[model samples]
Target: MSKAKKSEFRPNDYVVYPAHGVGQIVSIEKQEVAGFELELFVISFEKDKMTLRVPTNRATEIGMRGLSSPDVVSQAMKTLKGKAKVKRAMWSRRAQEYEQKINSGDLIAIAEVVRDLHRSDDQREQSYSERQLYEAALERLTREMAAVAGGDEITAAKQLDEVLLSRAA
Candidate 1:
């Protein structure tokens, strides 16, 4: 791999880790391993209370990126407003796709998962796994939305819920 681009991330910058949602860069450290010097970015996932160390050289390769632009977030919100498109496929197959979308770290894809999985007050209830995936997708979307919107997670979540609820109505 060509040497990773110079670290564009700094301490306190919010970044998205494809599999983990949003995290804050806590620090950059240099370590010596196997006679090679390596630089790593230490990131903290507040909601999960988990810390991750990613090699600075591999950050881009791993899909680590900055928060979405406001335009992207707006597009994601619009996605939530679109009609749900549940496939005729088996639930297990759909669930797997939803999981992949949530972990892809793409705002619009996560929005699609939220759109498809959301159940209205008058609609039939979701199965246990459906509800789990729905919550997971929602949480991931909101975390990135919060980072981009300059608000806390709760407010961002409420905004997302409001958008989805309006569509449901």
Candidate 2:
């Protein structure tokens, strides 16, 4: 690191990267690239088993953010319980939109994807693509919920499923 506490983020901070889900700032490191010293935030995604090095200067610009507040999380849960909004667009278009929402790293938008794509026990079966997208959104949402509310992702996922199930019935 160029200096201690050089950026808004610090070691051990859980942050959300737009393309990825929740990750922790493992450390700030300085690496030499093309004769220039670059200070980077080393973010570790435990669920994905991946590590990404983001330049501290561009972290905010790249949509790296702290966890959503409790109010925001509550809103996401409420969204999950709301009616599914399936647009009239073709499957390809809808899939693209859902993919964007999952990658955008906005909690509510991600929740919307999960809600819209969810299927109850009696609902029609989903195509492979639809199932993939639905799982992606649920994974992201659960991870964030776990990070914010203090529990494992499995518990958070179960809670979210209950919310969706009640609405579906």
Candidate 3:
């Protein structure tokens, strides 16, 4: 058997993982595992105190991707303001589908989840699970957008909301 070639990853790089949102690459490390050496990219998410080690070469295959471009993030923000598409399906089924999209690490897909699940101030109440998923998607999308725009998450989120609101009106 042959060892796989390691792809180069740098510190301060923004990356997205399926379940976790955007994270910054802290370091690249080589460690011995079962008498073999493995190279890993250390990624950290401050919001969760979670660290992930992904094999350099396996990053893309596992849906790990760099921060989306500013244009891409802007497009996703526009998506948020678009008309909501609430399915007639059961809540459980819809929630599962939304979770899958979030974990896919696709900004547009995550934005779709956020848009469809978002409730306006005057809207009816959202179920606990719905609220949780909505917040998660919003956070994930905003973090990446902020990184791309060279701004903080709060600013990015507010910008996104502004775009959406303007589109809605």
Candidate 4:
């Protein structure tokens, strides 16, 4: 079956951003930038405010999509529970790749990075940078999940941890 076209966007619609966490579509507006007329989506989160502008027609192509279905979020949670891959490669290189994946706004890829970098309660220390990246990935992934699951950020974060712990055991 063909998918229906979106005729309008409402406030509080969950939207996935490339690098940041899932945000609510707070408003839509038209503005002139560089002397050209443009339309933009204003999204807001508890942590930050972001504005996303697409050529209006190219929004879908840029991966600016609505929140995933519950089933998709469940699959991402399952992915989070899997084994972590620690490549022997250098940290700087791996960090760059992780950043790219997070910005890609692919839920599964973000989950993988979060799972791989996640440290257990008893695990050894993480470098300052590693901790930073881990937090960023986790936040990005969970924000979308929360929006999909119809819950607040704290609940969503806890749910993600539960899935990881269940699989880790």
TM-score quality measure for candidate 4: 0.85
User: Judged by TM-score, which candidate is best?
Assistant: 1
How many clashing pairs in candidate 4? 0
lDDT tens digits, residue span 123-143, model 1: 998999999999999999998
Candidate 3: worst 10 consecutive residues by lDDT? 1-10
Scored against the true structure, residue 94 in model 2 reaches a CA lDDT of 94
Question: What is each predicted model's overall lDDT from 0 to 1?
Answer: 0.92, 0.92, 0.85, 0.77
Candidates in descending lDDT order = 1, 2, 3, 4
Question: How many residue-pair clashes does candidate 1 contain?
Answer: 0
Alpha-carbon shift of residue 25 in model 2 (angstroms): 0.7
Q: Which regions of candidate 4 fall more than 4 Å away from where they truly are?
A: 1-11, 51-55
User: Model 2: residues >4 Å from true position, as ranges?
Assistant: 1-6
Candidate 2: what lDDT? 0.92
Instruction: In angstroms, give how far residue 18 of model 3 lies from its true place.
Output: 1.9
Root-mean-square deviation of each candidate, in angstroms? 2.0, 3.2, 3.2, 2.5
What is the Cα-based TM-score of model 2? 0.95
Clashes of 2: 0
State the weakest 10-residue window (summed lDDT) of model 2.
1-10
